[model samples]
Target: MLRWLIGGGREPQGLAEKSALQSIGEDQTQNPYTELLVLKAHHDIVRFLVQLDDFRFASAGDDGLVVVWNAQTGAKLLELSGHTQKITAIVPFPPMESSKENSQLILTASADRTVIVWDYDTGRQVQRSCFQSTVKCLTVLQRLDIWLSGGNDLGVWNRKLDLLCKTSHLSDTGISALVETPRNCVVAAVGKELIIFRVVAPTETLPRWDIVEVKRLLDHQDNILSLINVNDLNFVTGSHVGELIIWDILDWSVQAYELNFWNPSAQLDAQQEIKLCQKLNDISINHFTCDEENIFAAVGRGLYVYNLQMKRVIACQKMAHDSNVLHIAKLPNRQLISCSEDGSVCIWELREKRQLPAEPVPTGFFNMWGFGRVNKQASQPMKKQQEDTTPCFLEPVGDLIGHSSSVEMFLYFEDHGLVTCSADHLIILWKNGEQESGLRSLKLFQKLEENGDLYRAV
Candidate 1:
């Protein structure tokens, strides 16, 4: 729920398209984009963290307090508290500029099967909804003016905080995750299949939940753990079997696959012949990240970056983090930020300075370089003006403090504060502190864009 309210003006339609790769191999140049702040915890666990735009940031833990911090100063501003159980997810809704709303709203889902909407200005819950089933995943679609929530069931809620539409009918799938598109359609990974649903509030029919099965590619060697819509057409699906499959949403077919584990069947399952048993034994994909430039997926051991478009593995570092990564977020500026069960948060430079096979996120391949800007063609691959590699991971500029537990998830709100939630039962917010020296390296190409070292001379 990042707000484009950066002084709210004109937003370029979207990025152009790019090529979709099958796998990332070695020799591919790869790096991280933004500097990461590994917030240190002092108590139970630092469950999660998030940014609230440019104003504030929040982080939560089992400690109960949702610490709000200054985005630029990293000063603790306030605390958001109220949940009795573990907080699972946190999202910030940047009020529409036209609405003239002063403060923003923070929405949190907890293991208590409850969703709390907070008015950060006062650090209190303005409203809340209780569910009998645990809330597994959540995504807010402003385009459709609705919020989609999934747990034991998939449902939709309106801006008025009303349960406008819901159906326990999909209970069979036991929805786990959700992703929304520009058109406002909601795609959910529920049951044994990937279910696509749209929100429709007809003047005649009671708001309805339309379930469209995109692909029944079932018999998952294990549970369909997570479904991420990288962009509009290309989505990535992760399974308990450690096999992550990237699918072409438009065609409802598997475009490529990442095999971290063994799959019982080959259909749509990303399988590879890895002679090394250690690589596949417990290589869990806890997170999937894409710079819309290159692709990186987190395994049980470390992070694996590849140019799926070129089918080359750019970089694979073992023991980058202590445990399996819990989640990964690609920043708006094309940086990769991630949090893991290892109780650490890391930011990496994503732009490779040299040419590398482009393997953007599983789905955003079409929209990464602004491909879907015009809806050119389905089979079209994206090509950039330069084959030059851009430095990926810049460097960690700052560190966040407060959470006392394992940081499960963290996402930047772009020029705003960061929002994170953890199993510790609270959501922590991190305000973007001062730009560290690392940002200087970011201008490497831009300064050198015009002439080789001549731009620096002039």
Candidate 2:
């Protein structure tokens, strides 16, 4: 003020510059992923989780048991046991529009090389069929009454497990992921490249179904770890190289946007910048889920939010999980649910951001020797400033903790709470909106493990 008054009034320019600098000094903080309830889900490693309906979800484990749970109350609804080996995939059959049947069917593929169809409500196996090789993944095409299974080879089958077409011509490498598009196209991730196929009509020469590879997407430099179809024309993929690629089904020529976990800035110190670069190189996107305009990514142990249209990370929560975050799901209320190899499921809510008052610089503009006048000037507002500038961090609003070993995967729905499967070979159903103090559910699990004949010698 004294300088402005003495030097022909430069207050406006000086204040504007100060305001700009202050804004630049503000640091944005993200919310931590919290836990709600932990259900001891499986007796063996939970390999797959699937939502059966708005109120129910099912989990498959290495113990060869498929259990269904009520999401709202964390109650076990039914246990479907049949598979002899690890369950690799589980998917709910799409409802038939023309039929009036009330019961829903679930298809489970296993390392035993068989696909079993079960009446989820009755807990009975309705049908079963063996594949030529161990089935690693399954995608149901309900409109045509056919489903695709991938393992040592890829095969198309009817609802009755009658093999329609089987082919190994697509790749010498095994398929890792499978997704079907609205345009009747199937995208198969074979090692590093994606093979797009369309079913050919059956004829006399081939009395069964046939598929022809339409296009091969080879944009990724490393193995494609996960694939998801955003819409009929758009899809997203995460690679082993920590790259997220978005592609258009209609036009492969449209360049894919490769996004990374972190973007460093010029102001960061050399050591800090190098550490960030190394972190991104070490991290790989493990799973992803989308809600409206944003995509939630589980990159290593962190959670990142990317704007779909802008193609950039808007927010991130580092070290969301102590171990690799294997799966992430977005809740209806805009919170996120994540499961990790750390054996926990967490819930995170993004709070509204507010501009906090900036802190006083430790050193003065004009310092005497190496010391400054900050200590003398900071006395009045030090406590307030310290409280305001206490780096905002996301803390999990609720925590679920019962899994004994690595939590392999989970499925969640707004109407249903959460169902997680683990290496412990138990499946837990977490109820939505219910609050209990300090993992009371663990006792329930202990009692069940002791009394239930499922784990004891017959």
Candidate 3:
């Protein structure tokens, strides 16, 4: 890899070191390789895995047991045992500030139709909460001392794991995933919809939940895969229809949309087949991430870069890894990191570019015109894609991959490596990127940050 970069006159940065890894825990699930990029023969498959926002790792498996590993060392810090059926999902809680010591705690969901809060450091069960149906997805809001869990039904609980509110069968289909936002933790279910509810402290009231309905979204035509909140007022979501929808949290209408290309195959199809991609229902939005400049989204076959303010598709690259995309996230320095079901983790540099005009007429002035213009946003569109054949910018500049299997989730450590979890039942520590890119996204964002257009546009 280094040789290829050097030959191209691109010096490798310190973060570009080829990855070498060691597995910490063995996966014990059956026929795990039935999945992509995962090495089943070498490890056991834990069904539900999470690298908590705070960097703690938790996973529950077929054994009806849950194990918590320190996100970096992959060391078995604690083991939770109780469920009689397969455990489906697990989430960790941040340490309470008032506690004298940092105690490790997590919420685990199971097929046995119950949810349990375990003290990972001591392997003690803080609370064992149950439901009528199997548990599928779980989310924790430590600051609010509340957690959300759902399966056939959706329920909210206090930090102690007591049922606070129940949206009995929010959808006919089972819940898929849950995420906490400023107002609530939005839950996506098997049906093409989402239920957003405010986190309420346990209290006696009319709704009694203190939790209120934010909205009920039925934007997708089929089952929704994942929901990523870009900000307090906006979110990006993917569905089984291969449609990626970006919406304002406060409004119900769709703001921007793109098709998840490459679901058909890897070979780039130049035959301009104008298909209606307004909705994407490919492999289900497996993972999603967005920085201040770009929204990085992936469903099995897609890697989409949607400009936040521009509201346009910038780069839609297809990575054929023979499996679904497990996770997509942003590094501290803002590079995009992605992992797939095929057992591969990739670091992506958000390359920015401007369209060159059809006529190569060079403008000799310093004024705003042509590619030489200060803002591509202000420049006229090229006559078409083919006539403007030259690449305005091209270079690889970020390095942020560090996983041996399908990295499911990650936690960032400033100035140090990040913590990640993989299907191989191993957690990894990765250094952030050090290389620089010649990509246009780099300088474009730089300009935006420098108030490059504020003085003139404003």
10 residues in a row with least lDDT, candidate 2: 17-26
Candidate number with the higher TM-score (1 or 3): 3
- Tens digits of lDDT, candidate 3, 1-458: 11111122312222222223322222322111111111121134445556544555566566676766554334566666798887788777767676665666777777788888877768889888768888788776767666777687667777666677776555546878776665544545456877766655644555466556667877677677777778766777776756678776665468887552433332333222224344333445676788776777786655666677776555655553446667777754445666666555555555446764565534566544445644564465534332233222212332223343455555555433455455555444543223112333687777876986745665
Q: TM-score of each candidate?
A: 0.63, 0.72, 0.66
lDDT of each: 0.57, 0.67, 0.57
The candidate scoring highest on lDDT is 2
- Angstrom error of the Cα, residue 140, model 1: value is 0.8
Give stretches of model 3 more than 4 Å off.
Answer: 1-43, 47-56, 59-63, 71-74, 95-103, 181-190, 198-207, 210-215, 260-283, 320-322, 354-458
Clash number by candidate, in order? 82, 29, 19
Per-residue accuracy of model 1 over 1-458 as CA lDDT, tens digit each:
12212122212122111111111112212222222222323234556566665666677655545667665444566767777776777777766656665667878888777888788878767888998787767777765556777887777776557786675656744677777643445567665466666566554565454534333455345556666666655877776556677777665577776663332223342433333334442566666767554567776746666565664345554455666777776665445666766556665544445555855444467666667634554556643211112233233322333333566776566554466655544444444323433345566656777557756577
| lDDT value, residue 361 of candidate 3 | 37
- Which stretches of candidate 1 lie above 4 Å from their native place? 1-43, 96-103, 169-173, 204-219, 260-281, 328-407, 411-458
Error of 1 at 348 (Å): 5.2
Off by over 4 Å in 2: 1-42, 72-77, 100-103, 169-173, 201-208, 253-255, 262-282, 355-395, 432-458
Candidate ordering by TM-score (highest first): 2, 3, 1
